[model samples]
Target: MSVETDSHGRLYLSSELRQKYGEKFHIVEYEDRLELVPIDEDPLQAVREAAGDAFEGESIEELRERAREQAKEDAEAGFERGKRTAEGGNE
Candidate 1:
């Protein structure tokens, strides 16, 4: 569908579109075009729905510790890879 912005640069969505999506949108710019991404009205609720069972059996502190450990491991692995690259080693 084609949409045009007004003099004030406000692109109005149709009532049907607004009802399907939400009132807010994020405009993403790419090399050839722009895309409108709908924003969730309740972002936290959206995250909860998206996560589903991923975080089901973990407490907040437990999750935080797990994330920290994973991040540390990732950083160490990246450092090892960089070190190998600097030493002219191919992986």
Candidate 2:
């Protein structure tokens, strides 16, 4: 998705990204691109900063793999949320 800046050069968030990342992630719109953030910062930090209980016992490599999986899940969830909202938020 893309965002248009105002005449005063203020960055405007893409509602598209917001709706998509509902409870999963967030996108910070910049003049040229967007920065992504996780919904949960994983305050637990028992392992990697992003690992939860399901991964507390995993190896470092395993934890990386799990992080990838979780990121994909969050992205898909966000995309679906965006789709639903695009369909008039009836979902």
TM-score of each: 0.76, 0.38
Give the alpha carbon lDDT tens digit for every residue of 26-77 in model 1.
9999999999899999985687689997878777799889989999999999
Model 2 scores a C-alpha lDDT of 0.70
lDDT of each: 0.90, 0.70
Best by lDDT: 1
Please give the lDDT score for candidate 1: 0.90
Q: How much does candidate 2 score in TM-score?
A: 0.38
lDDT tens digits, residues 1-91, model 2? 5667799976555667657654455678999967767565453462455444666576778867988999999999999999999989865
Q: After superposition, how far is residue 37 of candidate 1 from its true place, in Å?
A: 0.6
Worst 10 residues of 2 by lDDT: 43-52
Clashing pairs in 1: none
